[model samples]
Target: MGLIVLRPTRATCVSLACFVVTILCLVSNGPCRAQLSSTFYDKKCSTALGTIQTAVRTAVSSERRMAASLMRVHFHDCFVQGCDASVLLDDTSSSPGEKSAFQNLGSLRGFEVIDSVKSKVEDVCPGVVSCADLLAVVARDASVAVGGPTWTVKLGRRDSMSASQSLAESNLPRATDDLDDLISLFRSKGLNSKEMVALSGSHTIGQAQCITFRPRIYNETNIDDGFASTRRRRCSFTDGDSNLAPLDLVTPNSFDSNYFKNLIQKKGLLTTDQALFNGGSTDDFVTEYSEDRSAFYRDFALAMIKMGDIDPLTGSSGQAQLSSTFYDKTCPRALSTIRADVRRAISREHRMAASLMRLHFHDCFVQGCDASVLLDDTSSSPGEKSAFQNLGSLRGFEVIDSVKSRVQEVCPGVVSCADILAVAARDASVAVGGPTWTVKLGRRDSTSASQSLAESNLPGATDDLNDLISLFRSKGLNSKEMVALSGSHTIGQAQCVTFRQRIYNETNIDAGFARTRKRRCPFNNGDSNLAALDLVTPNSFDNNYFKNLIQKKGLLTTDQVLFNGGSTDGFVTEYSKDRSAFYRDFALAMIKMGDIDPLTGSSGQIRRNCRVAN
Candidate 1:
């Protein structure tokens, strides 16, 4: 049967509202395990939104539809003031079109879901986290939160005090994209075509305004006559005059590859969809992604994982906010129980070590599925400095002091410091795009901190892929994983300062790509040195980095290598062509990477902070 494109009205929004209710109803969990996926989609913020939309779509009367439409909001307001759910307000003074515009921005609506997740976590662990940081975590978690898929989302993102209406308009790609234009837009954000395609797959869910596709629906003068005629009936030519409809009704809220199929038969109603098939690198990507939704889904996930590794906070980053929910801040009554658990964990010893290792795997895998492990450092932002120094004075030991203090008050040293640190790291990394790396079990905690070790071992922002690869190979990591790990550039941001060399100097770059960047770079003398890694899709998980490199738009010299015809060149092309292959390989590589140099089985003591191996 031909597909039905649903144009949400006063009443249809109600059904959409039910989407949230149904999703929330499905989520339930126990203490030990998390049914995080169930409540992910049906969140209050989304439901309330769905209710308004449903009413608008289903309204049988004009007055009713107008009243419901009055309730519609925009991305500008929702994200303007911390995504606090105030964007839904409808005032008589406001223009009806303005209200509709806000409600129509479903692609930018994920922040609301993140806000809800933070609220739940805040309820359990108050003042322990900032909504900004949770927004980053929940962005990744929302995917997992809805049982969609997992990828690392780095922790420590600060919420922007303002949303740039101009920038969002300039940066956010349209539903209509041709490969060239899409590539250009991602490039503006410092992302490549590969990540562009991967990120575009985000159309797997979320709703779009019919106006966005008016050109494709009615004016595709070059398309098949029958296809164009049918689309026009559903979408009018009036610019900015539109209706709300999901990209994929089959799996309206699930992250998948149906969007790709829509493109295959020229069903692509967006300029963006038709752009991929305009016959370029994106065409290959579309072909591959279309053949296997699993591949698209998986690679979409792995690319997300690799992209998460981009410009991440590590060892001593103190700029971002750290969530305190992962800490053991129990009262006196709970201390005893905590200590008992600690003691039991300590007694199992090997089992505890293994358990720590198991949990570490989830952090980075949630984004790009890469396992880039680091010592548990409690500090916010990025640096070689450890964030857990206060732990020592807070208790008697550094890493375990906080845990011990709380545990002592409640269960009294029952929980091992190592176990606590392991759990905290997983939570923190997942908050960003970090993955759980394999740790050698049973490492004893060091009473002292190691500044020298962190500097020597941790990867830096300035390091090229070779420098990073060398560091990994020294630790026995394979080349494939090394290249795969670089994909982390998809999520985090890098200071342009880190890429000035490749952008301006020919010392370490391909002549053509470097020169172009040098000319386009407005601040090579200053800002160039400050360009960051994950500029493109910094909040998304995708393989667009690979696409960016092909365009000479890559910001870092190290970033360009994956596609610069090197040994790992195959990885670049392969990843671009097959999202599934990238997904599986990246997953394996991440788990393996996490395994490197781990403090397993009494080799080293587990420190409470991940930054310090001591």
Candidate 2:
């Protein structure tokens, strides 16, 4: 499906505000409903609601059956494990998911529609909206697509990391369940008989497979004779098990009270559907809904609201909703403050730009951009700063301290050291000639640091091709990203100790380049001597690093391996020829690298000092 861009009008905003107020008032009676808010994303991602609505409308317009399919997907998600989005997970070798259960294997549909909406939202705002909340809003938009009632969807639900096929098999209602069985299943999910009857009305708009209704029509006595004859013509005893038939014969594709009306005429397609009105406890409610269409719409909307509120992960339970506008309201001048300080530091020393950027990369690789690298070495804990890779080599600690001090002057305790390091990295890139990207905020600083992990996780300069690829892969980056991110070396400098063996013994290096490097860095002396990583335009961030590799002028063993007739040689050639392609991929890789195992929400705290935890 294609993305539909929508801008909200003034009247639409007013109407949505009024509806949000009404929903808040209605849900205020209970404590469970207070965990979510109707306006949770009003400031975080303003275009999220409109984007989801447009995407759902486009999908349903392409195929009218997708409306009911979307609604059913939401229902199935909420029923199993309390709307945590466990149903959307695909079954892996280690984790068997809900989608492969006997109840949902071939019955579930509209997964691609949800996936499309997620991609569109991530384009506008990444790491902000959860899949669980997306399902809730998609169900509302799908209802309005096909003459169904709409309700305000309370947000702030988080996605589950695990899925349970056993829970799906036991918790979901079956096609052949009687009235007592249906009531008990709904009751297990905290829904009453009235709400169960209201939710059952969703079958009016979707078609059912013949396997689900064959026994109900052929052997059941409660079904209408004419309806049974019509159904039996398509579904035989042994064949045509997957043949399709509508649940409501009157209006199959409209979300009306026709499903309830069909029950009164003994035309409910599934055995569990006809059991509602076959001299059961739900017969009176079914009769009332068939007579009053407005009543069915009202109860259905209310039931949907209740179902969406089932056991959601709210507050500090799940991952924090990171947004680009996270500090807009709290500290309006946060980005500018960081940008100004970073530029001043770069002006004093051009190499400081590369230093600050390297600090971010090292901090993220070790402990997920938590500023653990900035922590001073204490007697009790060695911290990452004293690790073998960063003992006396890493610089720009005072620059980060200066930036954090200035940020604290504007908004104390609201800004995180982790977020400050991330923004500083972006600003340092832009200070020189580098591509800029939006930095997702809301990461918290780690209270503790690990010396052992830092020693193990950080990549070494002498690493071979396979070792380099494996190190980057451990942090969720591919070989292409590894090559693109290595472009940061286009502006930095490597010490003599890091690359001495490459120039002295390696045959891949150019003879002239090795002779020039040996003049500054001898074979065994001047281990602390510095040499530019890129021989041409060492201060600018460009694709010259890749170009140098093509000429066999790479300064480090890891650098030369990227173009040493390996799997990454094509990427090196492509980047050497195209500067814009390198910049774009580098920026995307930076953003992806910043998201590695972040300490978000309440998992970590905002440090008062960059050197010490609060």
Candidate 3:
């Protein structure tokens, strides 16, 4: 006996059990060197395709009807603003986005599914995978999940920074369109009549709302009488406008030539669906597709490939300069060598993990992770190493030097000191059992250091909540990101001088915790004595720092201020309860911080020694 698996349907598929067949009909013939490639992210983010596939399959398996909605999202996104993910943006005060456009408001679904896939991809390769490429891949995976023909997805598409509601309203095809209208719309997008007929076969799976097909059932003479009556049972003149019915009456969840078959029998649900066979120029193509499913699949694949080629951004266009695989070919062992060194260093001294992580944070806060913090003081100008905030507190220079020396041995002058710092910070986090995020490479070392920027930008241990928030804000971070990044204190320590006044003078602190801390950090003496930032688990990276904040056990004034009934207090409480949430947000925040103004693309030279310029 065969096992049966029950798959849930999306609430949007209620009663309708059908899917919409919107066409991505753009095309460019002759194939004169495609801008996008199937192997675009092969080295940059190897797991990106697999991650998208898993997320799409999981979503479709949970809600069998979501396959069509996911595919429709890609069509809608591509038609408006050239498949740059403009449809995915929510409306803001400055610009009304495509989500609220007439065709997409309530008709479109499966946005949450795309959001879930993006989050999963971001986890493995943060700042590496573009949302535009994710939509394209998700569309393909959704088709395969429902026993549909698969196609190669050309990647390296970058997401748009803005969306357009007017463009969506003008560009998207309407269900009320007739044969000429549909053909003209496809023609405007560069698709011919035959490609239009093939692409419309996507109606084989998905549901359509009553509002879309009501006029066809009530007034259209080309539609079948029995089909109209069946549709009219649920769709009235004005009521049940949101109710749904399948586009393909026979197999709504499977992809095949059933839509073409329905068109031939005059049972097409939408006016546009019936227009194909109402003695129009596209009638012969529709008849051909209905008879041969293999022919339908072949043309559909070709049409989709053409649609995906519409105005895609590739190479250096509309993308950030940094990439995760910057050294994949030049220095294949760069990341591995750095990771191994970080692990050995952490194993020898666990505190080294926190030091390395903090080193990256401090470097980015000042001059944007350009390795300026590693520079020794020169005769001409002092470096960030001599800044007041980093003077005697900063550590891990030797660890960075050791890693740089080892990397130089294998691929001399190929890996930059700045890129090594970013990778090492991620490796250190994993070594200490914290979250790991991908680090975008291609950052070059700064020729000079700015002690003044380091002193002003880096947050102080004695800073108040407002001061901390403002400092982070200047570095392109919000209060929530500030709170998440501060969670890094879960594994580090503060010197006596930094927290002495907080232990002795602060009233919000726990008395017992203060007394224990004061034992090693005496007043006016032992200024260099250290106390664990997270007293419970000082050597492990977790959410205990937020827990300590809740109990007034935070070692630094800045740490306690995060949970002191301020704007960020809620974040502290939430992290204290959910460690996973804290880790996820922390990893994202780290990637954002790593993007703060950096030297890349011929702006700076790669240094042989991390402590000085080449």
Model 3 residue runs over 4 Å out of place are: 1-320
**TM-score of structure candidate 3:** 0.50
**Model 3 clashing residue pairs (backbone):** 16-244, 18-206, 18-207, 19-206, 19-207
lDDT of 3 by residue, 204-307 (tens): 99999999989889988888899999999999988999999999889999998889889889999988888889897999999999999999889988888888
Clashes of each: 149, 0, 5
- All candidates in order of lDDT, best leading: 2, 3, 1
Alpha-carbon error at 88 in model 1, in Å? 12
TM-scores of the models, in the given order? Answer: 0.36, 0.53, 0.50
Residues 1-614, candidate 2, lDDT per residue (tens digit)? 00001111111110122111101101111112326888998998889999999999999999988998999888988876466666787787876778888888888889889888988887887767777788899999999999999999999776555566755775677777677667755654557889999999998898888888888888899888999999888899889988888777788878899999899999999988888899989999999999999999999999999999775544432234467898999999999999999999999999999999999998988746678888888899898988888988899999989998999999999888889888988999998999999998977777777676677668777777766665565465778999999999999798999999999999998999999999989987999999999989899999999999999999999899999999999999999999999999999998888875555555567888999877
On TM-score, the leading prediction is 2
Q: Higher lDDT: candidate 2 or 3?
A: 2
Each model's Cα RMSD: 19.4, 18.9, 20.9
Candidate 3, lDDT over the whole model: 0.79
On the 0 to 100 scale, the lDDT of residue 228 in model 3 is 93
Top-lDDT candidate index: 2
TM-score of 2: 0.53
TM-score winner between candidates 1 and 3: 3
